[model samples]
Target: MRFYPATLSRLLAVAALAFSPLSWAEQAISDGVYEIHYNAFNSSFITPEVAQQNGLMRSKYRALVNVSVLKLQDDGSKQAVTAIVSGQAANLIGQAQQLEFKKIDEGKALYYIGGFRFTEDEQLKISLSVQPDPNKPAYNIEFDQRFYVD
Candidate 1:
């Protein structure tokens, strides 16, 4: 399948807005210098065509988590920061799954994304560790997310 850059750009723009920290009161967290935003959505949101074009696995039982980190500049402007990101998801039954994150760089935009499979209406506790830079300390994050297949 041939994926149009313009289409992909549009999709990403929409996703960025949907996942922006500003849109959610508690979705974003800060560590004095950096702000991290993380969220998960059902894979069904991405159509099979888009998934195939983007090299993503599309399945109703899968969920995708998107993470974005930004540095707070002196002038108040935010800049995208490169980070080594990884996480794990676990459910009440003690079933655990490790997330395999993929880094994506698009000009000034940088972020990490990972996918995991789960049963419908399953709730997961996600723990993510991010190292913003080689010299910077890693930040640990935890959040609860629920996925529903539609």
Candidate 2:
């Protein structure tokens, strides 16, 4: 079998440049400012007076999150913020331009805060609630920081 049309058009241009999608879209995720970490857990450890004495309206959880982007390289060295974690919710996590909280310090168990800047890239929907009898969860946790300018 002799087939030659410039060798079948060079084997179909090397199989269309090896099945290109622009070579995997240049590893996506670009358009910076990202620093997000969220955690939610209730693997049947339900304790809100035992989930309202077993009347449990709704309680089931497991959410672990992390997203980082703090690459400041001009002199003041700081380059350790390259993250990705999902239980869902993270197209860019709050899309940051600014989300200041820079420091709260105090951790032996858990309380070490510093959250700021989230230059948007879209896809960040978060909703969490837990309250029962003067325990906690009155409402105070909101974030929506999206930025993409130059």
Candidate 3:
């Protein structure tokens, strides 16, 4: 499906999550009709204005996980879909913290963001349960990433 330029613009405006240390690709899980995109990065990369606007704390020890769900239309366009998402992040030391997601609905561009704490050079396993439709089962997502304080 075609991910519109406007959608990216809005997502960046709201989340500003694309700014990472250098480069980090957003991973996607697809089930033909639906696609879930997610990623995690240090929140300090976020601009101060945007972080405050979103009521988020920017710190070296803090990170953010971003999730977005979309549906593929017949026209090859991607339409943002509302979803039920819950998750948690666990460090290698078995320290698990529940991720409380806050939905950012921009009408056509929707996303869920969760914040967590970590130390320098710490690795975290993030798992999320995403249900794009109440009638369907939730998609289980798990991934690992290392965060740095720099």
Candidate 4:
């Protein structure tokens, strides 16, 4: 099972995982050269076989976070770019959780996947910092989402 962020996004969307379209309204941060798409949803949306093949724990109580970086080419196309990503999730009650992302690189596509457990009615604020390369500046992104196991 190849862990492509776009592929996972489409699968999660079909499974009612609350995935937003790839528009500007979604959690996208761009630095004129690179754009990052951030997606998080309930892990129950993924099939057990796919989850197992991708090294993800298949549980309704788990949330999967994915990030993809794209570099805009001069010829009007987007290219997947690799980056170092790190982030954390926190609740309103001061409960903090760190995100340990596993990087996957397939050809020109790169993605970071991470999982965390959450309660049925809790909201988590996620923050991520991505550095595309040694010469580029880091991009910091912040967003809030609530996960429900039921």
Per-candidate RMSD, Å? 3.3, 20.9, 5.1, 3.3
Clashes of each: 0, 12, 0, 0
User: Looking at candidate 1, what is the lDDT of residue 47?
Assistant: 62
Query: Model 2: which ten-residue window has the lowest total lDDT?
Result: 104-113
The 10-residue segment of model 4 with minimum total lDDT is 15-24
Q: Estimate each model's TM-score.
A: 0.83, 0.18, 0.84, 0.84
Q: Across residues 111-144, which tens digit of lDDT does each residue of candidate 2 receive?
A: 1112222222333443321111134222223332
Q: Local error of candidate 4 at 37, Å?
A: 0.3
Give the clashing pairs for model 4. Answer: none
Residue-level lDDT of model 3, residues 32-116, one tens digit each, is 8999988877777766766666677789899888889999999989999999999999998888999999887767778888999
The superposed Cα distance between candidate 2 and the true structure at residue 29, in angstroms, equals 2.8
lDDT of 2: 0.27
For each candidate, the alpha-carbon lDDT, in order, equals 0.76, 0.27, 0.80, 0.77
Q: In model 1, where do residues sit more than 4 Å from their true spots?
A: 1-24
TM-score of 3: 0.84
The parts of candidate 2 lying over 4 Å away from their true place are 1-28, 32-60, 75-150
- Residue-wise lDDT of candidate 4 within 2-58, one digit each (tens)? 555556545644543344222235567777888898878778878776677668877
- Top-lDDT structure, candidate number: 3
True lDDT of residue 31, candidate 4? 71
